[model samples]
Target chain A: MLEQYRICQTTGLRVFQSTENLIKANAVVAVIFLAIGGLFGLSIALTRWKAVHLLPADWFYLALTAHGLDVLVVWIVFFEIAVLYFASSVILGCRIATPRWAWAAFALMLIGALVTNVAVLMGNSSVMFTSYVPLKADPSFYVGIILFAVGTLIACFVFFGTLVIAKQEKTYEGSVPLVTFGATVAAIIAVFTLASGAIILIPTLLWSMGYISHIDTLMYRTVWWGFGHSSQQINVAAHISIWYLISAVVLGAKPLSEKVSRFAFLLYVLFLQLASAHHLLVDPGISSTWKVFNTSYAIYLAVLGSMIHGLTVPGQIEAAQRKKGYNNGMFEWLRKAPWGNPAFSGMFISLILFGFLGGISGVVMGVEQINLIIHNTIYVPGHFHATVVAGTTLAFMAVTYLLVPLIFRRALILPGWAKAQPYLFGLGVAGISVFMMGAGTLGVPRRHWDISQADAILPYDFPGAANLMMGLNGMSAILAALGGFMFIVVVVGSILFGKKIDASTEVPIAPPEDARVVGEYGNEDHPAIPGTIALVGVFFVSFILYYFVNWKYLAEVWPLR
Target chain B: MSVSPPQQKIWWNEPVPKSELIWVIIAFIWGLIMFFAMVWWHIYGEQNLSNESYRITAEDFSAKTEAMVEKYKVREESGYPVVHPPPGEDIYLIARLWQWWPILELEKGQSYRLHLSSLDWMHGFSLQPVNINVQVHPDYEMVLTITPDSAGEFGIICNEYCGIGHHLMLGRMYVVDERGN
Candidate 1:
């Protein structure tokens, strides 16, 4: 039993051996998938750039299908599973429940991912991620996805089981840690997301195998997005959890109000999944009332939840900084922050970009009327790249900087590169998001081999600016790929060849003195966080302006009803 | 803080920060406003998408489109019909594997009930230059009462990925002045 547990010297949390190994396995595999998916993404971006035109039409579609599966589904889900384990066992100082079952979950997920990749590469399953019915992929493709979803479902159970174990053993006092609570929210959302996946994909599998004669196309889209869009909701919950964890671990920041933050998470549990309706806003067979109600998340309660998080995350950070004597002015705390630390810089950047770009654009386009201009355009991808890539992916990348040192027990190799990685990647992805949105606004189609309409019998010439946007997007993707390569190298190199850490190894940064006392309330005084409030004020202004701008654009379009 | 258990035994009873409380109230109000704005748009905005749709077979939809084409096709553009249906009549646009068949001609400022459905896989009805888009799915006939505010030659691009040759799937619409240019 002694051998089953080891105390982490850096944070002093008791890490369960099985849990650590599971995290390592999941994280390493997640990175491998990121590399594969990133490569596919790069090729697709190049092909979209008319000047480059890197891949043939068939290959472009193939690359797109692979890219969506590997990145959107595989890479993010794998990483999220790791986060679940970490938040449960590692943070709670309890042994992971059913370690053997956890291992099986990992194996099943790995196999499923590989099978799907094989199916995609076989040149038959190029149905683009939605795989909307009549356009069938190989039977194996659906089988792989179903298996993967099942594995994820099992992992979510394991997380729940671990939570129960922590409670039974009385791992700590009071409620579970806020990070654990947030993780619980993510796990609950994941269960719902995977159930939706099963509901649709099982029939899709049958249809692909010719066991079913026909599948309703509109029905497939409506149900698939329950799986599709909600999967990103899982990302939102998981990444927000990471945002809290990073703020706590790196800056010793406490939630400004735990009640508010946790309530926001609860809102996610209740209403976030309704965002699936956002995709169907422009589709037929759905009522405007259903679309309006569901797309706004039952009166935008979920948006309110996000708004609360947006304020509290930075608010807590500001409060923490002020307590450390950076209270000279509203801007001093931010100006004097540890910008050189990749963990802090990456988290901050993720917060700002996700709010401004992802959060704002998502709400703007999700409007029932406004969706007509943006649905299925490259703008849709642009909006998500901001949310998933710049927002969730960047936050994930930020946490990895800390995870390497804490879990891997190795100093991050290439310190300078690690510091620069987030900024480089963030800038590149932001460019991709902005430029793609610009092109999309100019009526550029997504998932097309050629926006130039080169081979069309009746070609429509896009504005010169649209071509410029694609070229810029291609360049930005290359830059992001380089940043991604640096991250992989730093992480993998550290795991293999960097100096190993022991109990006596000196950690460069220390938590705030109060944080050293486990289970203690660190921010009892509740220092005023004027800086964060001002920042959030700016965010609100921008969001309002952008929302109205879209409404203005909608008014300009030809009248329709 | 988050990595550890709450300092208070019962965190729910903790006092809410005035600032956070204020912000939450503000956010909730904003959310309500955003929701009402969409509802407001449906009543006041002219560009709202109609929920008017019916379930029709692919074969049935094709037959209606072909009948309209035979009746109103004045010319052929690249093997597809250049259909000039009278204003206020129902116009049929069929989406298929790789094309949006039957080029449409309409007078400016005229309202027509436009019908869109796919004969095969799902497609996107992306009318460019004015840049309006809607999803086109098989067996679901989506109808829209559209009045072209600006008259010109407009292009319909399939934004949704149907398969390989998706980019080549283009259809045209010519909105002429009263003189019928």
Candidate 2:
């Protein structure tokens, strides 16, 4: 009788009341913010394509500002938070830590998002979102940043509190659950992320308040990016964790090298703290040696983590299929795996595309000599689109389609379209990225509203090789925009109107005593193999958003016109 | 709680077995190889480490536009004279927050290396089509060398967002392959 009560409107997550439904509802809300960022991607491309830099100087800076904060910072981080919550609360079999606090965090973030959006739209925070002074903006913009950071910090505290409780209760022991492990690592990184924010936001606020005499532009840029770059790694770890969850959700498969994967995630936590220095490689204030080491060693370590996953995830997939008795040729496992499983297939395709273009391009962009050509150019944007926008964010979107309904006991609405969105964004962003690479080769700089009049090298008159590429970037954004709209519909519809199903009995609904170590449950026959893995699906991470600055990634000549 | 309790001792929690000690050693050795390889390329890598240096509007293009602006109400900090071509330099190169002019200029026979850089927010000093660029922080030093083998006007553009005027940051270098005496 008690089990049956779990299925009713009073207790079950029938769209809204239950924690599961509430969590999915929050995810849908966050997606709206990400969509705006996605749209800005196209706007930027079009601005460059027409060589118009089109929006008025102020409006252009506003859009550029929103594009950076909204898309780059907010989109990925919020999505990561949502997914992390779902993984911890439902997937790991725990009640969300203080459902009220979670809602408060959401409210604070939502309000912050609104305030910042309005401020930017009104041209109050047009300092390119970097808060680099000499370029001033209204005070509200700085306030908005502070509020947002506060909300995020509160969310982190809430997450940490729950994990501590989970560990003390000893729900399970030995090794932490792989998804939880990955999340814990991301939370660990959040300590640095919040610390870095305090470093940047506090000073910026001081400057905004006129409480400080000066905010040295060079020092500010360096420290800000330290916070900036490391946060991306957080996005990365979470995305990988989701991939692990996705494989389990769809295929009942676990990772190939449990120890190796967990170690790699921990590497991100230990190393990425200092890797933020890579963003300042070209800045003159820092020494060349510092730049070289930070770029090559620090950033590369994180990049190596991606490389490992790139190789390992597929290897596990292959091995799993093989174990399942698909004894065909080398590529047969690829064909045999369920492409129809939205999370698994979508994440797989996103991975392949990002590996060559986003990952390697990011590595190249971080190099001392190579950073010169690409920094702050369309190429800079292109590189990141592949990484953050295309790579991390897309993974999350895909995973959400599967996890959301499952958590809420709602059947997916338009599961077919849910599957299609990934391919669309992947293709569109690919086109955009290639176009940006061409522009980088041709020398088109980023962050300009219009290039049309008598301009400089990437002159409004003639953009050279980048001319065609910029236009192509616009087309890519447009295509991706369409895909983004479809994503909104599918995700929102799944949570709101889809038919309801009972949360699986096989799937645990209560928070386990321990989530630190992952092991199989039930039956010695299968023994769940004590299978430990971190293969993920539906983790939405983004590459394009990270490229919003283009300043660190590109370099331009002195004013020519 | 309807959910089954998690199993004990997951694979990830297990300590490395003795058999894998050799693998760790091999991994260490491989890491050393990779690190050294990158260092070798970095310290003495074969790249287009060569470039040419020339100023735009080098007294030669000295368009009277130099007088285009009203006489300064005051002298700038350099005190090099509120004069157009500051003493000791034959060029009146005017670069705004984000762009440069006359991207190319060179003597046909004279071999020269351009010391390129920025004077503000990290600007990109790049020669398009070739991966020759670097960040030019204001108060930072930059050195670029280019040996123009032939006579021609090459395009130069800023690839960084020094400011809103970033896209217009363009410069040129014309190699007078053989500057007649």
Candidate 3:
């Protein structure tokens, strides 16, 4: 197996053929689901917009169910499996152990994904994403999810096996790369997430089959969100790792401080799981003490972890830029940086949007008192879209741009469109998040098919501003759909029809040569990059202002004594 | 660009950057402050949801809510009951499929302990205009002490997805002036 592994000539990294094949397979499936999920997302946005009302009631629910499963579960998890494999085998310069088991995992995932989607499309499981108890769906629905989670669990185990192989092989000298360490964090979280899913979904399957008489609603919500919210936490770790990997692989940027960064990852393992408490903040069964303790005490540590990543990722980039002699003014380094590279631009956009829109809003909404205002509103979706779509999905798209040329040995088709696609997509997603949050602030419900409620026995009308904001949401969704469409076209076209490149003599996409100068731990050799410091200051100010604004908004919500 | 693999360094024992370390410390301090602030708000904030909740069966709560509605039956309309309970008392609101039962009428500037429970599935007690949202779950009664500051008709929409008619699940609360008209 060691003899069969070959070095990727372009990047000079070891690539096991089985790992390469698995990466290609999972990434391709992930993209296909992204395309399908984006279609369902577009339909959902249109239906919720109220003016268009594209899908009928039943179809609206169906599309919503599919959109959640396809995007949130299938697309993200499949891509993450690819990331796990790459980080383990390729980055560690080790041949993947148990290639047969890896194949079995992939096949199980594929079958599970297809089974779940078919079940959803069959119109039997319109329980939406949470699938709260007593609103039972078909038995196939539970089976589909259980199978999918089991497959992902197997994949996570396979990832762990490869890590053991890498350790035995002594692929790297002192330590695994920071990106691999971050993926390890993600894989660990995935095991926890998948196990939580089994705990809830197995009994759920039994109940759907009448094996169990009743599934306690409160218990189901508490346990199920352990699975649901932790899945997003996995995304957070994975995408942040991608951010680090892209900065290193694309810009040759080094971690400003590896020790602090690794500590942040450690914080994620200990405290980030507490964020599942934010979902339960407004629930009746939970006590205030539990809610406050989990949401504030444990959750803020997780926020601290994100805040560290927020500062260091860009700080590393800025230091690298300055080292390249771009350090002239407050922003000379930033201005001179590579803006045309899709990978770099997409990642930078993801960082900014994730911090400002997603990160800030998340902390605000997680507050126990303020949560009463927006828990089940469109604001919930708004925050997650910022994190998941803007942060994770966009980051994934950015890396896929690199993975195409690097892993597929093909040059990207439509380079110009690829460069512009990130901006277009980022802008559209930003609009959707903002407009949705604005509408939610005006008391717009989240999962309602129509805000108008025109067909109700007693008709009701939302505020005119809500109507207008939703209309803007509709327009933004269209723009985002176009961007999504462009992404699919670019990636699929590149994979299918792009020109092949000779890796032996040429590397088309290249980073700055001396950018990856990671100094020793606690080394204070690098000068302070003033621009990053200033930018971080600005981020802090924005966070403070937004947080206070929410408190003020909560203050104004009819002073209840 | 020369494509070379990055040199692997000590993973766990890397030296920390002074600035990043400072930032981490500041972040930790900020998190602590935010935690304390949450404690402060829950204690002192006027907009806090009720901490006076207790567990109860769905059937028992429904029966109690029915008794209250019968005791304070102001009118009946369209197979639904409308109860106008007096101010400064325990107000019962039952959430069922596609409607919040017994539209409650109250007086402005008066606090009422509003007990909310679900009959079949989970529902969201979303009071619009006021912009207060809380989850209504079956088998557990949630108590919210609310004071209507303004005299107007506020809509109570079930924000949770209950079933096909979740959108239609609407209730109204009338906060009236001193005349109680």
> In order, what DockQ does each candidate have?
0.81, 0.21, 0.55
User: Please, what are the lDDT tens digits per residue for candidate 1 over residues A142-228?
Assistant: 989988888999999999999999999999888998999999999999999898989999988988888889888778888898899
TM-score of each: 0.98, 0.80, 0.97
Per-residue CA lDDT of model 3 for A1-561, tens digit only, reads 344767776567888788999999999999999999999999999888777889988888889889999999999999999999988888888888788888888898888889888888999889997888989898888888888888888888889999898888787666677898899999999989888889999999899899899888889989998899999999999999999988887767777766777788988888877777888888876777799888863738888889999989999888777777887989988898789999999999999999999999989999998998998999989989999999999999999998998788788899999989999999999999999999889889998888788777655678999988888988888888888888999999999998886655457454436544544324455757789889889999999998899999998887653
Better of 1 and 2 by DockQ: 1
lDDT by residue for model 2 over A1-561, one digit each (tens)? 111113332223222133564466567667888888767665766666674454556556667778888877777777777766755555444455676777787778778778888878886566775666545667777777777777777777777766665567554454556788788788888778878877887877777778886566667777887777777778778877777766555554455456666667777787766666656654544655576667655435655566556645665555555556564655565677777656776787667667767876776676665565566666777777887777787788778766654655567788788777778877887887778777766666667665454543333344454567777788888888888888888777777897776544334321232221222322221211111112212111232233323333333322110
lDDT of 3 by residue, B1-181 (tens): 0022234344445456677878888889889888888889877898876666677888899889989988988887666677778887899998999898888888888888889899889999899888899888888888878888888878888888888888889888778886457
**Roughly what TM-score does model 3 have, to 2 decimal places?**
0.97
Kindly list the per-residue Cα lDDT of model 1 for residues B21-64, writing each as its tens digit. 99999999999999999888888889988889999999999999
Q: What i-RMS does every model get?
A: 1.4, 7.6, 3.0
Candidate 3 residue pairs that clash: A521-B14, A521-B15, A522-B15, A522-B16
**lDDT comparing candidate 3 with the true structure:** 0.85
Name the regions of candidate 3 deviating beyond 4 angstroms.
A1-3, A297-299, A515-525, B1-15, B77-79
Off by over 4 Å in 1: A1-3, A512-524
How far residue A500's Cα lies from its native spot in candidate 3, in Å, is: 1.4
Return the lDDT, model 2, position A117: 82
